[model samples]
Target: MSFDYDLFVIGGGSGGVRAARLAAAEAGARVGLAEEYRMGGTCVIRGCVPKKLMVFASGYSGAFEDARAYGWGVQAGGFDWDIFKGKLEAELTRLEGIYTANLKKAGVEIHAARATLSDAHRVKLSTGEEFTAKHILVATGGRPFVPEFPGHELAITSNEMFKLDQLPKRLLIVGGGFIACEFACIMNGLGVEVTQFYRGAQVLRGFDDEARGHVADLMRDRGVNLHVGTDVISMEKTAEGIAVKSSTGHDASYDAVMYATGRVPNSDGLGLEEAGVRLGRRGEVIVDAYSQTSVPSIYAVGDVTDRINLTPVAIREGAAFVETVFHGRPTSPDHELVASAVFTQPELGAVGLTEEQAREREPIEVYSAAFRPMQTLFAGRDDRVLMKLIVSQATRKVLGCHIVADHAGELIQLAAVAIKMGATKEDFDRTVAVHPTMAEELVTMKSPTRTA
Candidate 1:
């Protein structure tokens, strides 16, 4: 049966947009995309791009202090949220324009409203238009999930962080995940009296224990009031700002309460179940290796699938989907050996298996080091860096690489290349160290700290 378009993309995120573009431009197929909100989706519009910009803006405060230690005259002013926000919004607009232009250039129709599946092959948009396609790509992505609780409406998510009219004098960030830790450090650096309450033994619970501990220590040393084993019991608006009661027997008033506990897939009301497409308990679209859904004519990618959820990973999935369905290449996304970085005050970067995961499978040798970097030491700060290598003892191959330091994100990208190629401990030992560099630690650390 002939359809209105060859492919219908249900989202305008990196994944959906890329899939739509590739299907239309490269494969010479007609495509239509619908995005209820902005064109760039979470990563470009509200997630990584803006958050990284805030991270950079916040780091300037520390750089100013370091400048003084290096004998350079330094005077740092109070952070002007208005100016920064204006520029941030402009940059986001610029990125949105680029995405729009790319889609238009690729001959993909853009719909400015929400689209839901009418059936396996038909989609109805919010504007009452209906279209049928041979293939439907669902990449609707995810949203910050703030659980319902007392005075929950008073609390904001990371999505509203960039839109604040004014910087809060005191900000209460709840949760122990990467988003919580990142904003805790960010707000603190921006001169907000930041208090972080994580209702767990430690923050960044899923990361390497040693690495997270070091990061938490640095966050505290840098003036973030890090409190673990605590949670906000209730909150109400007061004259000061927001009054908060915590499970840890504490009371406080804050200008704002932000929850970064987690995110849920954007699958609700997408007509997936009605159309006979299966979803996970978390409302994530369940898909096969090639991102094909239960309904062969439909597919989902990116955070909607609850897979890798990274922007680059989504793009890869989208491209792979195009290859599989449109070009008949049957390409599957490579989800292994993927490196990622958390943009907290001392970034955490890792690739491959964690020591805990490796030890569970087989014998592993863990090489770990924590040292005060030369720059922070010169500044008379208590800052320290961590580098750990989890190696398979039997095969002598590096199973994991973890780094917690400034630019850990940048460093890990290069380290990930070696790990992806199945580089062994001997390969690292063979490489000459670049002197006067923190990255040299990745290559020079020879002995195992422990074997598990």
Candidate 2:
């Protein structure tokens, strides 16, 4: 079959851009990519990058307080939403330009419009260009999902939060996931009276139980009105802003309400089913270990496949896709023991399995330490931190590692390497402790607190 390009990628997200660049420049295969909005998709444009900036920006309030305790005359001024928002938008624009520049440099054609599947090996772009490729890659990623309800339009999603012109004086956040709790902390630190409602018993539902509890406790202690076992029954608009009725029988009014309930894979209206591609109930594309779809020429990776939604994971998946299809090397993206972080202050960084998850599948031992970090204690704040290890009883390998402290995200990333290589509890014991550091707790805990 005559093909205009060897690979045609839909959605120029992390996965698509990586795949397109490698296949075109390295593998010497003609590749084309199209994105409806910006070149960097969600991560660079909206989600992780901007959100982390806000998290950092919001934390200065506490920083100034800590400085005062250290005998420094640090006075915190009011947060200026306009200045921060302008800078954030500028940074995102810079990042988007980099993504586009890289794609162009790699010799991949970029379409500044939407593209979708016409068939197994063809793509139709919004610019009225139809192209046939030897292979089609779907990397459309996902979007924030806000459930339908009465007056739902009065609330915004995480997407809109970044674009809000002014910070709300009173903000109500819904859902208990990492996003919800993170924003709760961010808003609270930014001097907003933040209230969070989650129907679940706790926030961070899938994380280590003890670690999540520490985050919840600290969030509440740090001034987030966290109301678990509660959810919004309805929200309405009024002069005060959003009037919220909680299922827990609480009624309140807020300047803004945000729903961070979840996200859905961006697989709809792409003509995948018509092309004989299989999809899961959540509209996620069904793919093999190598990311090949039901049709030989059609493939998917990243959030579109509903795999690990991390940007690095998506990039790895994309590289694996190029290797398997174009380079003739059979490779399946390794998803095991992937590390993750929840950006809620004193962030949570973790890898492998939670104690609950490990115990459900096998015998395990848990070691945990919860204490106030020296800095926070010095600042006269009762803020606490936790470090835990979940170890497999049978193999004695560290099954999971969780940390709730400052820079947990950066720490967990390094620990993930050792855990991924199957580091055991004894191996951790063999390492000497780094003194006077929060992470030293990881090495110094001499005994298991419990076993299951």
Candidate 3:
């Protein structure tokens, strides 16, 4: 049966865009995509790109101190939020342009408006336009979730955090997740009086236990007023600032408060249910292994599907979807052994199971090392880095690798390649160590720290 297009993608996010581009450019199929907001979605627009730049800007303060310790006579200056924000906005605009250009070049029709399913193979856009397609794809992604409470409207999420006119002198961050921890470190480094509140006993709840503890210690050492096992009871605006009352019986005032509690899939009001598509309890699109929804003609990917939630994973899922439906390859995006990084002060890079998870599954051996790197040692800083490997005893394969240090993100990417290839402890052992490197410890450790 002929339709307006071969595919109509509901969201122009990383996943949707990739699928549209591939379907049109490679598969010779007519494709169209619509996005309610910006083209680059969360990562390029408000999430990873901008946040990583801020992380870099914030690190210079410590770099200047270390330079002074190295006899470079460096004088640190206060951070200028306005200048950085201006440049950041421009960068996002440039990136959005690239996304649009790429889609156009690939011959995908782009609609800069909201699109929702009218039927299994039909889509209606907010622009008062309707179209029918052979298949539909949803990749609307997710948004930061803020819990309801007193004065909640006054608090901002990560979306608004990027667009703040000025940095707060005393910023109160709420949550125990990576977003909360990363911002706490970023604001502290930029010289903001940063305070963090997490109701949990510790931050980074799902990560390796020892690594999370190490990060908490270093964050406190760097002057973040982190309060675990605590939460905001209420908040109110006053002439002075935001007055906050906490569960721990502490009352304080802050210039601003930010919430990074969690994120929810953007699957609401999309006409999915009305169109006969199933949604999970969290309002996530229910899809099969190949990202096909219960309705055969409808499919979903990325955060909207609530699977693996990372940008790269979404792009992979999109590509796999195209191969499965358009190219007749029947591909399913691999979700196992996927590496991830938390961009906290001392970043955490991890691939595969955590120590807690590995031990529960099988007998395992854990190799761990923590030490002050040479650069920080010369600066007379008490900071330390951690390297840990979780190995299975039965098959002697590496079950997990976790690193806590500067550039842990970079280190983990290369390590993930090895781990993804099913590298064993002996395989790592036979490799020569990169001398005077923190990562060398990954290979040089002769014995397990402890076996479980």
Candidate 3 residues lying further than 4 Å off, grouped into runs, are none
TM-scores for candidates 1 onward, in order: 0.99, 0.99, 0.99
lDDT (Cα, tens digit) per residue for candidate 3, span 1-452: 77999999988888988999999999989999999899989999889999999999999999998898999976766788999999999999999999999999999999989998889999999999999999999999999998898989889988888899898999999999998999999999999999999999999988999899999999999999999999998899999899999999767999999999999999989999999999999999999999999999999999999989899999999999999999999999999999999998889999989999999999999999999999899999999999999999999899999999999999999999999999999999999999899999999988999999
Q: Tens-digit lDDT track for model 1 on 1-452? A: 98999999999999999999999999999999999999999999999999999999999998999999999997988889999999999999999999999999999999999999999999999999999999999999999988888888999999999999999999999999999999998898899999999999999876888888889998998899989999888899989999999998878999999999999999999899999999999999999999999999999999999988799999999999999999999999999999999999899998988888899999999999999998899998888899999999899999999999999999999999999999999999999999888989988998999999
lDDT of 2 by residue, 67-137 (tens): 99999987777899999999999999998999899889999998888888888888998999999999999
For model 1 the local lDDT of residue 391 reads: 96
Q: What alpha-carbon RMSD in Å does predicted model 2 have with respect to the real structure?
A: 0.9
As for lDDT, the candidate ahead, 1 or 2, is 1
| Alpha-carbon lDDT, every model | 0.93, 0.92, 0.93
TM-score of 3: 0.99
List clashing residue pairs in candidate 1. none
Give the residue spans of candidate 1 off by over 4 A: none
Candidate 1 structure, TM-score to reference: 0.99
